[model samples]
Target: MPTTSPFALLLDVDGPIASPVTRDVAPEIIGLLLDLAVSGIPVVFNTGRSDDFIKQQVMAPMIAAGMPSTLKIHAICEKGATWFTFDSTGAGEVQVDHDLAVPGHYSDEIRELVASSFASHMFFDETKRAMVSVEQNIDADNTEYRRVQADFDAAALEAMIRLGLGVERLEVSLPDANSGIEYRVDPTIISTDIESVALGKDLGARRALNLLSADGIVPGAWFTVGDSRTDYAMADWLAAHGHEVSHVDVRPGDGIPAGKPYPVLTAGDLGLGDEVIHDHAGLAFLRHWRAQLDPGMVINSTELSEASV
Candidate 1:
């Protein structure tokens, strides 16, 4: 058996591992992940996706790629509300933390608001176990889509406040390319997820650690990769705990800084940057890490010399 690495790679399913446009994992990416796991590197998929999606989109492909039975795959899903592990065989039974579910009454009201105000532009996702989500068919240049999403963001905040969650309205933003100084209000144009304020990627990272620790495995170094701005919260949390963190921002220009708490590198900075592409970056990152584990493996080129190990 190969010796496991002290490091673990925590990934967000969408964007970094799966393409945001097609919502599919590339065959090469799946094969690389399987190879990494077999090489004794722990891989955790943490995302806003549901267990069913994880099974169909991630685990299923990995099993087909010959994921070893000895390899254990951990996942934190629906942001931080669901947790589970899968072996080489099939999808594991999921364990959901219902405590993180949005209040029933609040969910009902939010559902009505979306149905009444934004039904045409958005649709409720029933697959969500702990949160209420309305997904918008996003087109970056579409003015109408942006307007409807902003309207939903405002209405959702008002609903949460009226329910006395005591949480302030959260707005996702991005730095404008032309003027790096200006930050634009960019709601998750693809999906707006409303759940308990206690649940987030940061909490998910901790949850993943707790689960792994239960198995007597404590990670030495941690790396997190995601395509969205909110995903930074995970790396930030890990870094705050004094762990060396390597953060890969597949989308880039999310207005977050690199270094200090952890070092942040963009997909483009890693030699796979493309305006609307993502899978290439995912492939490059996995290959880079795999090379680190195998001394015999030679990397043709990379810019992660300054990244936190």
Candidate 2:
């Protein structure tokens, strides 16, 4: 009923929307997302999460909340190796690039590695159709997950090398003298996703744009929200391709990247405290955007002018 929102959202799932600890989205967050969608904003989820996870944790709850069929939402999952769209009826077709998948043996090896060595802290995600992911158990402590994460990664890396596969770990500072690394063992706050070097958030952003175009919708601008450093690729791609965009780092405690061309802001900019990170910050961002879209809304004290970087 309201005019279509001027901005579209490209979002990552794990930290920004879903709680990394519980691996579930809060009802308030879901309500806000439904409001955003009902107002006709294009809400596209781009993440390393599998389509199945998105379907269960995101789409199922949304559908149960009575999402309108008119709202077409797209999800780019497995870091762009797979994707799907859904509306009120249910999920639609899923598209996966088999060529982009890591060798099946790698997933098998990694599964055994997790089960054998890191079962307490992590579990191999079987729902992933393309990339191999080992997620932190919902009950596992974050500190414990981080403690065993590197050992699992190293074991997986050694397996890849044993199989004569060229591989690297994501976010590693150094690349070897040999320049033929093909895949990366990427570790995040609550998971380790081993995927092709080619698969990234940038690819997901491009896919989201194409999906929106296919639906005959063009947003005036875009907002990308994520909790990790890798999530910057979405905003990076949009900015490089000449789109008006801003990026929000829901969790900036790790460190924010320097010298980004587009603006990068956080809930902290909007008067939230440092302790409110991850999904809480994400919820604040959604509220901020929602307030901006509907001028009738009012903030008690904080100035929106101060928040815009």
Candidate 3:
């Protein structure tokens, strides 16, 4: 069945598109994606990767592997914390719309908590809002992940109470067992002052989406893809808002649900999973969904791009 709405193909990087280090992208899958592009289907890659990293590592190689130069491919990087558009006119340069920089005007108490806790573990990186994260190696088998996690949790709560800041949202994430902890802080409850440090690491992706939506990029026409639990905010937001397509879980055990609130596609294993997405089963699934939607639905990719500009 032919797709009607010119669907947005949201791809996750590590699982569905490319492998790490080798940076090998599947040729047949690229061909299929390019075919989708030629048919005017916009393919936007959404992942936890940063903007500079995606261009140097993922997009460049993909274009080298036959993806079109003018392929209207957009990227939501940093787990959807930042948004970028590849300028086909400028040697494929990526333009950033949102960044994970901490907002200015953070309460002094929040800063003190971060400074006090920063030395206990090498795991802490930066503080945003009431949350602080570090880069300590976590033993998935040690049962101590919870203990260390509790420490962070306690710190977050104390910081909020001491500073008279209210919690909006908080999360402690382990992006990699070897990479350390990733934390998020949402302090809209404290004030709309928008402190630079209040944005936190994990909130980047969700913040980017909110920024895009505010610019009139309706959720129904948008799609998001990611490899890990860190990407959950963007995925959850899109699903709750009824996005047209939200392809997630491009990595093995990315912890994506088997049946999602939205249509889900899993790549099975990293890099090699691209082959599965291009197979007959994958195509059939897309086709079946496409046949049900109305044609000529206007999607506002420019809204996201314009906001970034």
Candidate 4:
């Protein structure tokens, strides 16, 4: 850890900063993030959201919260395939940084197959640029999305194979295991991303850090917060680079490893308690940091136990 409070924050958009189920961002968290930025702490939202989602769900909210026109924010979207910056004006154009984007021909083929074969189970995201994604619509009468997800993934894989698109399997664990849910390729169960194997959160974090460094604004220590196992990739990358980075798992009981291969602290370890899960817990996590970073707040290392209930 840095001798002082960390200077930058790398956050995952969904689950940590936004509700995965409803896809909403709380106004309080938005205001807190903007205030942190104004306090000279750079915040980089590194996530799998597309540029369009980032603009509507994130940038627009900040603008409404009185973000200055001159203030700039950094974001790594589509996991690691796209990177961009937003000014007080609004979300800017994203630059696709990797050659791993699924070819248009391949994407078209996959889309056609999904639409023709499993239209009821999944709906494709039109805003996606580097990758293709299909979201699952879980019905209250039939909430088993995993079964549909398996069939959909198999079909999508077959389509990719037919198109000679290099493919790989990405496993995502459930946000809360106690919900009696099993881990699947889709962590949120709301969407499953089909992108090149080369793209991931680790790459996004590395790219964001490099970009921030280029601007001569390197952070003393880094902190990454997310609600899924996939989010651990960012912390894994930072630790491998010899940077002091802390990983905060906002999910209540995901059962991720706590040290070595992936040093992590559960949201409960941060005072969120074991029962507070999902977006509410995520909001609480952000609020804790906002208070911790207050100029008038003074806490000793040992006495900082209040940070973790």
Which of the numbered candidates is closest to the native, going by highest lDDT?
A: 2
lDDT of 4 by residue, 1-309 (tens): 222336578999887787766677878778878988877788899989998888998899998899987678988998888988998787667798658677787678767877887677667789988888877653421256667777777766656555544454554322332332211223354778877667889999989888787766868878888888888899899989988888878773757865655457665565445766656666665666666778576444233333222
**Where does candidate 2 clash, by residue pair?**
none
The whole-model lDDT of each prediction reads 0.74, 0.86, 0.44, 0.73
lDDT (Cα, 0-100) at 113 in candidate 4: 71
Error of 4 at 135 (Å): 1.2
Error of 3 at 186 (Å): 15
> Model 2 over residues 20-67: C-alpha lDDT tens digits?
878899887888899998887889999999999999999999999889
lDDT of 1 by residue, 1-309 (tens): 233357889999877887666678888789889888787677898898888888889999998888777778989998889988998888778898977787778778877887887887777777888878877653433456667787888777666545544443454422233323111112564777776667779988998878777777767788898888789888988988887888887777556664546677765565543552355676778878788778998766443322211
Write down the worst ten-residue block by lDDT for model 3: 187-196
What's the distance in Å from true for residue 181, model 4?
A: 29
Query: What are the clashing pairs of model 1?
Result: none
Q: What lDDT tens digits, residue by residue, belong to model 3 across residues 1-309?
A: 333433455555643455432335555445555556566555566644456656766566566766655554566654444566653432344443334333223344444544576334323333222222332232232234445545555566555444444443345332323342223442211011122232322354445444444444433354455545544555566556555545544342434565566655553322222334322223333333343343554323232222111
Clashes of each: 0, 0, 20, 1
What is candidate 4's CA lDDT for residue 175? 31
Sorted on lDDT, best first, the list reads 2, 1, 4, 3
Each model's TM-score, in the order given?
0.83, 0.93, 0.48, 0.84
Off by over 4 Å in 1: 1-4, 138-143, 162-165, 171-186, 272-277, 299-309
